[model samples]
Target chain A: MLEIQNVSVRYGRHQALFDIAAQVERGKITVLLGTNGAGKSTFLKALGGLVPTGPGASIKLGGVEIAAIPAHRRVEAGLALVPEGRGIFGKLSVAENLHLGGFAHRARTDEKERLERVLDLFPRLRERMPQIARTMSGGEQQMVAMGRAMMSHPDFLLLDEPSLGLSPLLSKDMFKSLRRIASEADVGILLVEQNAKLSLEIADYGYLLENGHIVGQGPAEELRSSPAVLRAYLGEEVVPA
Target chain B: MTILVTGILLGGTYALIALGLTLQYGVARIMNLSNGETLVAACFSAWLLFTTTGINPLWGLLIIAPLGFVANGAIYLGLLRPLVRRATSQGMLEVDSILATFGLLFLFEGLMHLGFGGAYFNYQFLAVPFKFLGGSYALNRITAFGAAAAIALALYLFLYKTRMGTAVRAVAVDPEAARLVAIDVGLIAAFAFGLGGAITACGGVLLSTFYTFNASMGAVFTMKALIIVIMGGVGDVRGAVIAALILGVMETLVASLIDPGLTLAATYGLFVLILLFRPQGLFGGAAG
Candidate 1:
């Protein structure tokens, strides 16, 4: 289990996240839905130790406090984040990118087996292994980003807008892979998304954030019918029965 | 024919000098104006080794090159790293780094002046001249060129075939992304600066075997290296070598065909033209 409590983020004078708390259970997907400037990204960054949190903030992975852990050390503690825009090394080949993703686990004997597993999860990546990452399409780059994180074999994965710029079909494919990984691989996924409908469809639980505050939280099925979620995110498009 | 051959030989030296600057500025974006000082320091160290211990200056490379590498690494860690950390903007970092290197240049110049004094010295080495393809050439010059080529080839293989080399390239391409992938970016930058120092200092050790020098010669070599790096399109390694060769031929031709006084002037004139037309250089990006 990964737990965040009373987490707050302030950038100079502006408070990006205020007293935010969330929990992610193993083998489950937890979706965070928010609009632009709603502090969804900030919360994810705080979780990954990519951003500093204010007083009273606490983060733990399986009872271990990781709030003070540095971003580089977070991976070794079984935490990984696929940051917004898919921060891929564009000049490197896909293989090199994956190789770097396994940096923390390099000493492990199963590193090779883990790499083969990532390749199996995204077979298209195997085909483009030798090509430079910059030459790949948007969907392909997203795969490399996810595939790279998977190479680390983290117990918890924090994804920030993974579907941005990807097509609807590609987004569905990505969600399917995420679902399989969460269930079969026993990995916890903390996902932040702008596409609330599609993300909620696969998420076991949902949190609705607005202006750096978590206004609502419940099971995904209840949140789908909640008036506040529909008014802020879903708009006129109703959740399919 | 002699002029052409001499130019080619000179070009190899220029390539060696520019390779260091290319690594410093082109890849790391640090304007290391003190590069010439590092080279001169290596030459002085070799000279000191020769004069004190009677070791051949050619063999002095084993000591001087590593000294240069360590000294340059100190410069990066002590001088440049703090500036990088304190800088709030990229432009500010570049400017501050350049200023810091200028300070280093003067410091090295002053130290050299104090240690070696105002006198010039010629390196003691075999000067047997050999005829090749109807042109007479000094054996030392040929040996220097061969050494430079071998070092360049080794550098190429390191950057292409090794794992740490891949990490260096990855950092060069995108530092922030490299950090996300767990690459210690600061360590990479330091390694690059140290390696740059080592390679250029090795060039200096070779140079000491064939050339006469005083403490102040570093400034002239520094400018030449900067020109070659700019002409070669900055971070492009292969382009730097080609541009160095071209500049060598141009300098030799102008010196012999026109007037020796106009050699650097002609080279700078061409550089201005290249900057005016293709600012990113021959191999730089569309607008680099």
Candidate 2:
């Protein structure tokens, strides 16, 4: 489980995020919904220790404070961020990319077994294990990114916009797989998504962010049917009774 | 025809030097203007060992290479790395890298001048020209080409096949992503700098034997190295070999068709043309 308390971020004169607080349940998919420039990615980055936070910002991973930890050290302590843009090395093969994920830990004997688990999650990867990752399609690359993150076997997986460029069907399949992964692996997930409806459908708990503030938080179904949420995202102009 | 064979042979030597530059540029993300300087430095060290101990140039490499690795790593950390980290402009990074290394080159040349007294020097070769392809062509190398080839192949294999090699390549692609997986990108950079230095051993030895070399010799030879690296395609080692061979053959042909004085000019011209057109180098599809 992860708890972020009053996190804030500033880039010189620009305040990117202001007072973002969210709780993520272990073994559950927690989705954060926000418009563009709403600082969803920045919030996730703050948790991963990639973004510097203000004095009041506090990130707790499994109840341990990671305020002082560096990004890489945070990863070493089981916080893995599969950043946006798939970040998978196109020049490297799928196997090498996944293998390198387990490089830092001492108990990295899980390569063969974890690889098998990854193949089960996305079997297409096993067939193309030796092929160059850049040669794979976007959806497949996303799967590779997720699989690569999974190789770390992190207790907390922070997926930043995993469904950004996928087709609608592919996005559906991705969310379905993400839900399954959280259930099967029994790991905590903090997902930032642009697709509000699809995200709330799969998420156990959801937070709606607008203008860098936590504008909404509750059970997924509650927020999904809210009229204001509908008007903001759906732009339907009128909410159904 | 003899000029052709010689040109190709020189190209082979040029390729080894370019291969070092490729790794520095393609993987390490450092412009590494000091590469040729370091190779020249290696040549001087080998020359010193040969002059003092009367060691065979080939055998002296085993000692000289490790020294080059340490020296290069030190230069990268002490000189270039800090400049790169502090630089805000791309032009500043490239300019500072180029000027600083060239300055280092002059400093190194000054030291070599003081040490060797700038007198023309050659590390006597055990070199014997052997015929290949039924004596139609001469490899003109006594283990130097073989050694260079072996080192290049070893580097290619280590980078593509090994775990650590992939990590280095990953760092080249996205340092941030590499760090996320917990690779100490800084350590990877140091290792890359070391590997780049280690691989330059044969080029220095061959330069010492096959031609007249002084501390300043690296200046001209390094240009040939740059041409080869560019022709081969920036980061691709395989491209480096092909470009080297082509430039070698080209230089040889130029000498035969025009004049020996024009060989260096021909190389420089070809480099300009390639920069204007391809800009990527020969095997350039291998970005990162």
Candidate 3:
């Protein structure tokens, strides 16, 4: 399990995240839902160590404290982040990007097996290996980003807005793939997304964030059926009286 | 035919020199103005080794290249790493690195002037003329060109084939993304800066075999290298090689056909044309 506690982030004087606590279990999908500027990205970045967390914050991966490590070192410790903008090396070929994904010391021993698994997860990438990542379609690039992250053989994967810029149909397919990846790879997924309905549909647990604070948390089924979630994020219709 | 051969030989050396600057700027994010001073230092080292210890410049490369690596690595760690750490953005880093390396340029030049006493230095090593394509050329020039080509080829293979080298290129493409893949961006940048220095110093050793150089002339090579780097595209290895060849041929043609004094003029002419027209470089897409 990956546990996050007392995680707070600040950029200069602006606090992006407050004291947040969350837990993500292996082989499960945990979704974080929030509106824009709700500190969803900041929360994910802090978990990945891309942003500095406040003192006393704790990020534990498989019972090991990892919050103090640098971003790259966090990857070596079996934590990978697919940040916003897809974070794939755009100028490099898909093959090279995937190759680099296995650069962590932990992943090097089984890099070949990981490559095979990644290709199985995103078959489209197998054909586009030689193409530059930036030239691919938005959905395809998302696949590359996810595929690249999987290449690290991460114990925990943090994804920010994985469905952004992807077609609705593609987003559905992406969520399906995420379900498969979590179950088959036995990797914990900490997902931050704006598409509340679809994300809750695939998630095992859910956290609702507002103004950098976790306003509510529950099982995915409960959150999906909750009145507040439906009105705030699902855009429930209001009929005339 | 002779002109073409000579230009190509010259271009080989120029390509090697420009490549170092490209790596330093592209991967390390440093616009190192002192790049040519390392080259000059290598040149003087080659001269001193040959004159005193009777070591061939080709053999002197073994000593000077590694020294270049250590020296450049020290500079990056001791001087530029702080700038990199404190820089808030790419533009700020560029400004800071340019200023810092600009200062380094003068410091190195002054030290070389003191050490070598501001005199043109050259040595006769393999000065025999070798016939090629119905024209005669200096054996040292051919040898220098051959060495440069070999080094460039090795660098190309290292970048394209090896895992560590690919990591370097990955950092060059996107440092933030590289971090996601577990690449140590800081370590890679330092290595690249050091390797770039080594390559540029190698170019200097090769040139010292045939060309006359003085301590103060480092700035001229720096400008020429900068022109080639800009003309090719920042961080584009293939483009730099092509641009350097074009520059060599053009400079040779201008010097031989028009006037010897107009070579620098022609170089600037091409620079202005590149900046005015294809500022993104000959092969690069629209500037981001």
Candidate 4:
């Protein structure tokens, strides 16, 4: 389990996240739903140590504290983040990018096996290995980003807006892949997404954020039907009559 | 034919010089205006070793390259790392690094002038002429070209084939993404800066074998290197090698066919033309 507590983030004088606490369990999918500027992205970055958390913040992965480590060290600690815009190396070939994904010491021993598993999860990537990552379509690039993260042998995978810029059908397929990844790889997934309906359909647990605060939390099924979730994220039209 | 051969030999050395600057700027994000001073310092070291201790410049390289690496690493850690930390953005860091390295260029030049007494220095090693393609060339020039080619080839393989080298290139492509992959971006940058210094020092040792150099002449090589780097596109290794060869051939043709003094003029003229026309580089895509 990855547990985060008292996680606050500030950029200069503007506070981005305020006293946010969350827990993500292995072999399960957890979704964070929020509107833009609700600190969803910031929260994920803080967890990955891409952003500095407040002094009192504590992030524990499998009973080990990891919040004070640097971003790369956090990857070595088995936390991988796929930030917005995919964050793939545009100039590098997909093969090289995937090879680098297994750079952390924890991933080194079973790198070949991990590569096989990642390729199985995203079969399209197998054909595009020699191509530069940036030249690929949005869906394909997303696959590369996810596959790259998976290569790190991460205990918990954090993804921000994985569906953004992807086609609706592709997004559906991506969510399906996420479900498979969590169950088969035995990895925890903490996803920050705007597509509430699709994410909740696949998630085991959910958290709702508003103005950098967690306004609500519940099981995915409960949040899917909660009045506040419908009003805030799903909208009145998404509510079933 | 002689001009072509001579130009190619000269180009081989130029490629080594430009490769160092490209690595320093591309991966380390340092403009490194003092790049030529490292070259000059190596040249003087080669001269001193050969004249005082009867050491061949080729053998002197074994000593000079590591010194360059350590000195350059110290400079990055002590001087440039602070600038890198304080600067808020890439543009700000570029400005800061340029200013800092420019100051270093002058400082090194002045110290070299005081120490070396502002005299032109050269050493004769393997000065015999070797016949090639119906023309004779200095054996030292050929040896220098051979060494440069070997070094360049080794560097290319390291970057393209090895895991650590790919990490260095990864840092160049996108540092933030590199962090996601668990690469130590800062450590890689420092290593690249130091390796660049070592390569540049190698170029200096090669040049000192055949060419005369003085303390103040470092800026000339720096300018030539800057021109090649810009002409080839920043951070593009293949482009740098090609551009250096072109510059060498053009400079030689101009010196042989026209007035020898117009070589610099011709070099800058080409620079202006490239800036106006193919600023992205001969082989590079549109500038990012």
Candidate 5:
């Protein structure tokens, strides 16, 4: 489980987030939804410790305060974030990229097996193991990004805009895989996406974020039907799934 | 014909100098403008050992290699390391390294001036030129030059063929991902910096044999080596050597036909022209 209390972030003199807070449950998918510049990516970056938390900010992972943990160390602490840029080394091969994902736990007994497991999940990667990642198609690259994160065997997985630049059909494919991954593995995912409908369709629960604060939260189906959620996200009435 | 042979051989030698610099800038990505300074500085240690005690600078290797590595490692730790360390989140911290190394250039020159005095000194070895064909080519000199070429070639093989080499490439490609995979990011950087230093001893010993040197020589060779690096495109060993040799031959031809007075300015002018045409050097694959 992951918890945040009174988190605030500043970029130079501009206040980006003020008193933002949320919780991601163990082994469940939690979707964070907002318009562009709503601090969605920033929140995930804070969780990964890529962005430093402001004073009085407290975050706990597995019940220990980790607001000050560095980004790489946070990965070592089993918190993995697929960054907004996807952060895949463009020149490196897919296999090499995944190998780095397992870097923090490389000395663990099952490291090689873990790599095989990731390749197993995304067989397309196994097929093009030697190809340069930068040359891959956008959807394939996204899979590589998610698969790279999966290689960490992280307890808490934070995905930021994983579906951006993807086709609607490909986006649908990605969400289906996300649902399957959540149901099968004990990995907790805090998926941040602009496609609120697609994200809520896969996630077990969802939160509506505005100006860096959670304005509403509930079960996926319940949140999908709220007048405010419909107004903010759907731009119309929510049709029953 | 004589100038051509001389140009080819000298190009080989220049490649040797540029090779060490190429490794540091292209692979390590530090833009070590101080490489020529470090190479020249390493020569002083050899020069001091030679002029005083009459020890063959060959034997001086035992001292200067480690000293060069330490000196390089220390400067890297002190100056360039901080800039390179935070390059990830900040995204390609480019101008910072140029400033750090430029500052190091003055520091090294000042130190050399203080210790050895600014006067140019002749640093030569056994003048045993072997006779071949109809004339003599300086055997010891050519062989010393050959050693640098051999070193650059061997380094190319080592970097491309070995696991450690691949790891180094991995660091070059991506430092953050390299850390995530459990590579000791600091150790890799230190090892690389030390390597850059160690190779300078090789270049220094070779250079000290053939020329008189002052603390001021670093800037010139650094510029030439940089020209070679840029000319070859960053990180390509094949490109560095070809560019160095071509420039060497071209400079030799120009000096023989035109005049020595124009060599420096003309060589540099050509360097700028080539850069203007292909900002990526000959045979460029990776820019960094």
Candidate 6:
């Protein structure tokens, strides 16, 4: 399990996140939903240790406090983040990118098996391994990002806007893969997303953030029919059938 | 044809020198002004090894190359790291690094003067001249060119075929992205600085046998490297080699056909022309 407590982020003077707390269970998908300026991205960065939090903030992964860990060490701590914009090394070949994904545990003997599992999960990457990442299509690049993270064999994966810039069909496929990865791979997934309808369909739990505050939280099915969720997300005309 | 051949041979050393500068600029956005000092220091070390112990100058590579590598890493860790950490923008980093290295350039010159005195020293080793393809060439030039070509090939293989090499390229392409993938970006940059230093030292070792050098000669080599790097585009390794060849051939032609005194003037004139028309350089990549 991954737990974030009292997390607040400040960029110089302006605060981005204010004492936000969240958690994701092992082998389950937790979807974070919010409109623009809701601090979803900042919260994700705090978990990844890319952004610093306030004095009282703490992050625990598998019973270990990881708040003080540097961003590069977070991967070795069984926490990997697929940051916003995919964060792929655009100039490197896909194979090289995947090779670097295993860098955290490069000394481990099971590295070859880990890579084989990642390739099996995203077979598309296996075919495009030799091509430079920048030249790939947006959907393919997204796969590369996810595949790269999986190459690290993380216990918990944090994804920020994974469905961004993908077509509806591609987004659905991506969400399906995320679902499969969370269940079959036994990895906790904390996904920050904008596609509420599709995200809730696969999420086991849901948190609604507003103005950097968690305004609502519940099971996926309960949140799907909530009046506030309906009004803000699914709208009055459509109510998840 | 002879001028072209001579120029091409000399160009190999230029390319090796500029390649290090280009990597430092391209990956870290640092304008390492003391690059030439590193070459000169390596040459001096080689000179000391040969003159004191009566050993072959070529044998100095076993000693000078590793020292140069460590020296570059020390320069990065001691002088440049803090500046890069405090930098808020790439432009600010470039300015700060250039100014810092300018100070370093003088520091190295002073050290060289204190260590070796201010006299011109030429390595008398490899004095044999050889005949090749209707042209008589000195053995030193051929060896220097061969060593440079081999270094270039080795660098290419390292960047393309090795994991650590890919990590370096990944950081060069996008540092933040490299960090997310679990690459220790700081460590990679330092390693690159060390590798760059080692390569330039190899060029210096080759150069000592062919040319006369003193403590102050570092600044001239530094200027030539800057000209080649600017002509090739900032951080473009392959482009630096091509630009080095162009400069070498052009300088040789000017020296042989016109006047040896006009070589520097012609080189700078060409540099001014390139800046006026194509500031991004002939290869056109990020000048940063």
Predicted candidate 2 versus true structure: per-residue lDDT over B1-288, tens digit per residue: 566666666766777888877777666677666677777777777777788988877787788878877887887888878987888775787788888878877787788777777667765565454676444343335356667777778888998888888888888877778878878777788778777776665578766766677766667766777777777766677888888888888978988888989988988999899989887765576433
**Segments in model 6 whose C-alpha atoms lie over 4 Å from true places:** A106-108, A236-241, B285-288
Q: In model 1, which regions exceed 4 Å deviation?
A: A105-108, A239-241, B56-58
Tens digits of per-residue lDDT, candidate 4, B1-288, equal: 899889989998999999999999999999999999999999999999999999998889899999999999899999999999899999999999999999999999999999987889887899999998899999999999999899889999999998899999999999989999999899999999999999899999998998899999888898888888988889998889889999988999999999899999999899899889988877788785
True contacts kept of 4: 0.87
Instruction: Judge candidate 3 at residue B160 and give its lDDT.
Output: 92
Worst 10 residues of 5 chain B by lDDT: B176-185
lDDT of each: 0.85, 0.79, 0.93, 0.93, 0.77, 0.87
Candidate 1 residue-wise lDDT, A95-162, digit = tens: 98888787664325587888888888889999999999989999999989988888777899889998
Docking class of 4: high
* Alpha-carbon shift of residue A201 in model 6 (angstroms): 0.5
- Please give the lDDT score for candidate 1: 0.85
- Tens digits of lDDT, candidate 4, A1-241: 9999999999999999999999999999999999999999999888877789999999999999998988999999999999988889999999999999998999999899999999999999999999999999999999999999999999999999999998899999999999999999999999999999999999999999999999899999999999888888889447365
DockQ values of all predictions: 0.56, 0.74, 0.89, 0.89, 0.29, 0.74
Steric overlap count per candidate? 1, 4, 0, 0, 2, 0
Candidate 1 per-residue C-alpha lDDT over B86-149 given as tens digits, one digit per residue, 9 for 90 to 100: 9989899999999999988999999999998978877666689988989998988888888888
Listed for every candidate in order, the interface RMSD values in angstroms are 1.5, 1.2, 0.6, 0.6, 2.9, 1.0
TM-score of each candidate structure, all chains considered together = 0.93, 0.92, 0.98, 0.98, 0.84, 0.95
Q: Write the per-residue lDDT of candidate 5 for residues B86-139, one digit (tens) a residue.
A: 776333656778778888888888888888788887766866777655667776
Q: What is residue A52's positional error in candidate 1, in angstroms?
A: 2.9
After superposition, which runs of candidate 2 have C-alpha atoms over 4 Å from their true positions?
A: A225-228, A234-239, B1-5, B89-91, B129-140, B285-288
Return the clash pairs for model 5, or none: A103-B180, A103-B181
Candidate 3 CAPRI-style tier: high
Q: For model 1 chain B, where is the 10-residue window of minimal lDDT?
A: B279-288
